[model samples]
Target: MTESRGQAPRSGLSYLPGEAATDPDGTLTAIGRSWTWILGSAIATLVPGVLVLVWPDETLHVLAVLIGLYLLLTGAFRFVTAFGREHGERVPGLLVAVLFVLAGVLCLRHPMQTVAALSLIVGLTWLVSGILTLYAALAAPDLPHRGVVVGVALLGIVAGIVVLAMPTASARALTRLLGLWLVLLGIGELVFAFAWRAALRRGDALPGAAGPMD
Candidate 1:
């Protein structure tokens, strides 16, 4: 989500597609209110991260498979979320989805990949997604809860950097680090979702906010 509900910042949303914010004229637009998919994306990430954390003893192969599944699911979530954006804004979401899917594929197909290889794939995806998300947040100052959006983007950027910089010696070590970041990312997205929901509610209660949804 370059702007809300969708990116690698992708599943929990390294980007939202606007990270679907991009609401012009200071009102909550349809896309701005799309918190459901955001929640779905968060769940996709949180579950996998939690699973990895709980099962750190799992082999590298198992870790790869789990990560692969998370990426694929995130890709799917991002893909659907892309449509919530303006046509011109769809490209970023679609791009993130592709990146996630490709990474997932690589992970699943080659579970025996070295720790560095796996880290490289995931880190790159997150880095790119975070950059896109930051771009969207900067470009759209009017985006609702812009501060939260920026915060999430920064978290993603940091997560990417840390993972790339600290390729752990073993699968267990990597598992702990990745799980922590994923959980943090998921929490960020979860907050964004509820924030959007609250904003939508407030907007609906406004004097003339019902026109778009109808």
Candidate 2:
């Protein structure tokens, strides 16, 4: 017997199979589910923030560890990217990779010292990034979400200033702030996931089938 045209066919291991391949509508609907993920990210950030607030001493050590880990990862990524560049490319990618590896190794070797040295360096970097963000926000008023850019820049600037003025206090504050941020973000992600799931269900509940005869 032939399959009924009105009934949507299910393909194993491939719920979304042929013809309906370019499921732009479905894809967008699925993407809507990602709000939960984004919210989770925000919530995760709050953990460190809270740690900084409640236990400043503990925050320092944690921050040091975080910095070391970040450096190691950065170095690895830089090295990989450098090597991944075109074989015959004249880019100084190799040099950059070497620099990154060297930095990573240094941090790993003297993780303790990195707290003082790396903290200062990272603070400066944050300051620069914050300034750049502010500049971009100001220059590109036409951008769709200029407010977000500005807000991020402002936050960065504040963080940088705090880190510079009172490294220890800033570290603690940052930790607590991060904790709170994470909690909030996690909730947001959960909400988004539910919303996306609901929307998809609604869309699939359309009335009036297109008649059978496949």
Candidate 3:
């Protein structure tokens, strides 16, 4: 339905007068289009996972290099974003940058230790994060993005388990496992991104001057 400015559209859907009517058809279409990007990200992540699984030994070294690059880039990004922001405190971003820098430096210093150390650190982080996420999911099943949060928790649990279960593995093996976890996470993120992109597109297409839902 076409919306007239300062007037409520048909359907009386809003409690407040003059609330716009949403165009469901257009919104859905927009959302679908956004999902295409997410799908692409998922495919990219899956490729790494497959390679790691197929050649665990060779993948381990590659994993270390990839992780180093990831840490460096991520840290730089965080710093840049934080510095660019005018309102928020920079401590969080600075701390993250420091951690990433440290990780990268350590990786360089002891390339052989890269995999084991990374596996331990990543495993612990995931374990804690997973528990928190699972708790949140259970506490608020109706929460938006609940499914994605739950999926992340599950992935974290699996990643943690894999790392802890093979602590004795060679550094190469550990690195490969770490890569596996990352690939899985990347896939999950891609999926979530697509879902968000779709939702955003749908919201954009909706008629009647729709705004974000609380």
Candidate 3 segments whose C-alpha is farther than 4 A from its true place? 1-51, 59-62, 74-105, 128-143, 170-176, 204-214
Query: What are the TM-scores, per candidate, against the unseen true structure?
Result: 0.78, 0.42, 0.52
Candidate 2 has a TM-score of 0.42
Model 3 over residues 1-214: C-alpha lDDT tens digits? 2222222222212222222133233333222223343344345445656666677667445665655555554445434333311122334435545665566565555555556676775575456545644654455433335577478668867777888778789876675677677678667756665554444433421121111000
lDDT of 2 by residue, 90-146 (tens): 123344334435554655566566344655544554455456546544543333234
TM-score of 1: 0.78
Off by over 4 Å in 1: 1-33, 204-214
**Predicted candidate 1: what Cα RMSD to the true structure?**
8.7
Local distance difference test scores for all models: 0.67, 0.38, 0.49
**Tens-digit lDDT track for model 1 on 93-202?**
67777888999999999999876777788888888877777765665545667677778888888889998988855666767888888888888888877775665554
Give the 10-residue window scoring lowest on summed lDDT in candidate 1: 205-214
Residue 157 lDDT, candidate 2, scale 0-100: 61
For each candidate in turn, give its C-alpha RMSD to the true structure in angstroms: 8.7, 13.7, 10.5
Error of 2 at 122 (Å): 3.2
